[model samples]
Target chain A: MSAVAQAPGPARFCLVLLRRQLTLAVRRPIEIGNPLLFFAMVVALFPLGLGPAPDQLAGFAPGILWIIALLSNLLTSDTVFRSDFEDGSLEQLLLAPQPLFLSVLAYIGAHWLLTGLLLALVSPVFALMLNLSAPAVGVLVASLLLGTAVLSLVGGIGAALTVGLKRGGMLISLLILPFYMPVLIFGSAAVRNAVLGIPATPYLAIIAAMLCLAIALAPLAIAAGLRISVDA
Target chain B: MWSFFHKLGSPPWLYRIAGTILRWLLPVTIVALCVGVTWGLLYTAPDFRQGNSYRIIYIHVPAAAVALAGYYVMAIAGAVSLIWKMKMADVAMKSCAPIGAALTFIALVTGSIWGKPTWGTWWVWDARITSMLILLFLYLGVVALYEAYDNKEAAGKACAVLTLVGMVNIPIIYKSVDWWYSLHQPASIKMTGDTTIDPSMLYPLLLMIASFYALFTCCLLMNMRAEILEREARTGWVKKLALGYRS
Candidate 1:
């Protein structure tokens, strides 16, 4: 879709923005990989500290993985608009004729694809390393896939709000982690249910509902936040 | 009627009115608090099972109730600020964070103290306590966001947005904490449900909760008065007020 570089239509603009974000992210392999590495290192620390008891490790794996994923996503989101904001591109985007809501969606979409999707993809390896049972791995990956998208969307609100601030690194976490708790709760619960051979669909359904709510609402907040941050 | 609404926008009017209201309301709040605390602490019958330790309920329940109510107050002030661009509402919203955080902290401390005597532990990640902890974080988050911005107006707008977002999430957070607790722990202790206790105990609790609400209002007005003075210090009215106070 982005290959067709015609007149800058709204759809084309969004596509271009998404493609630009992905391309920029791809160029910075280290930035893209930091969260994954954080994920792995934190997961590795668990076994070292908690002992190699498989049952205990497996029980905590779902919560540990979900929490680390939440943290990594939170960390990555703080930079979502930081560079654009600093370079004055964010102001241009704000001044553009395009709807800010759509542009914000594209930014958040690109972020989710880069950090959340990648995190979900690599979560199975972490799941195995943590000695999670085989059946729960599917639920683990599925929950992350859905849940991390919500984190990125919700986290985008905090990112947009703090993007203009000098010391947003720590403040973004405080602003967004309260919003992340429900996602973390349901995500891990789904996997725990899976590990126990119980029904996980209900928890997954709640997570999907959360994703839908975030998708419908978060961009509006993100747009408002960006406006405020830019004005600041 | 609408003149009163218009008057709310004027800082000096709000300051004067808040001062007048506080002059009456503050003493009433203090007296009510003393009466409620005394009634609950001494005049009421103790819990059949937990003895005098259960008396912590008076402070704990009111603090927790008022803390939860304080979020609504904060969020509603935030909404008013955002919707109407009311400077006074922004002042009210900003003033609310520290008071709410302090109340939430009191709730948490009292809950922990009560837990030590009842549950035999100083802390438990009980659903209510965990929710209170999250609420404290939410309050502190607003305060932090406000302080982080150099531009005061932008800080108010940003905090308003964040508060609105937190408002939407509060119910979900409460539900999830409840569900999480139910799944992980057996229902070892039942918190005060509706109408379970005798009227003797419940009366003092109701009085305490009512007084706590009054206390919250008094604190909110006092804080807003302070904020208005701080913001308007350079203005003519505030300068006159300051000279008058000094003289």
Candidate 2:
């Protein structure tokens, strides 16, 4: 009762929510593994479809890697708020003293950590599988690290909007995929520039700018979406 | 002003006002469109470089410009609905989607047709064209999102948030795509070079663009009138209107 009477500050609430999400995600190791597995399988499939020629694969490697990263992030984002909404914890969070803006960011932050963070870490292996140059592999990872965070944040808007729907899986893609284009464009451009032995810093800077913008703005939409979805 | 705004919130008043405006504006828009098209296509001199093919600009440019502007209209309407909880703004936003999508489709198709004559292909990965394609996708996404929700009120709100998000992203998308295109292709065929247009060609093009805006308004009002009727079917005013009662 005393703890309930003295509510935590917004920052503390966000950290608590972040920890809770990570702990829940960590409990289900398969969930964390699924996007990575998806990424690897897709990367392997591209070689078959586009021909197994090393140079060709290497030529297209940057785009192929960034696209797979975006898709994997898309797949995981739908579940960020689904379980909480299904279990009514989302409602509790809505009723909490803290503003939903920070709370929503915490959810997206945990999501980025689990999916985007891990994918960027392992992408160099996939980059090599596609015969991407060693210099470009570093840029691929850096771009994905920055780019997928924006994807996760934007995807959170779709996830929150459709979290209450029975058939939100396919619809979520239709809703948010357009918003994902800028990130994909800049992210892949950065890697492509590195592959061509040109400076990739400008593309990376643009992506970083997009990430900053998304971090500031996306949660407002996500929080509003959650409210509308829950209310409906 | 406040009274007018308050009156604007009344569905019956808006429906009647939209109908009244459409009664005069629709014919004017159609006539203006026909005049602009004929003048641009027949009266204007053939371009020295492209001949008659360049005249497609009358349709292509106007559609593309209005298609882009319609998004801002939708976003602003969405913002009004979100902030003011104005149901009319929701209807306005909802109505903008299909009109905007159709205009975007026109722009893309006309651009493709024009490209065949000028660029020697049906399409090119030019930045503006690609951005227009993405704009079409964005409009369709909004329409799809709106239809997916079972509850119409919530659907309006959800689509509103999506539009606002897209509004923020549109500039970034355009900039990034522009940079990406410039990086990949170095100064290929410019869509429109800096050559000064003759006033003879420019006047009709300006007229077409103006008429396109008028066309957009007409379509929006008609769509809104239908939406208001469907939504307000149970209201006495709508019932009276349907029964042909003037009052």
Best by TM-score: 2
Tens digits of lDDT, candidate 1, A34-141: 999999999988989999898899889999999999989988999999999999999999988778888999999999999999999999999998889999999998
The sequence of per-residue lDDT tens digits that candidate 1 reaches over residues B113-224 is 9888788899998888899999999999999999999999999999999999999999999999999999998876767644388899989999999999999999999999
True contacts kept of each: 0.86, 0.81
Flag regions of model 1 displaced more than 4 Å: A1-7, B245-247
What lDDT tens digits, residue by residue, belong to model 2 across residues B1-247?
A: 9999998899988988898999999999999999999999999999999999999999999999999999999999999999999999999999999999999999999999999989899999999999999999999989988998999999999999999998998998898789778878888687786778899999999999999999999999999999999999998998898899996
Give the lDDT of residue A143 in candidate 1. 96
Q: Clashing pairs in model 1?
A: none
Clashes counted in candidate 1 amount to 0
DockQ of each: 0.87, 0.85
* CAPRI rating of model 1: high
**How far out, in Å, is residue A55 in model 1?**
2.3
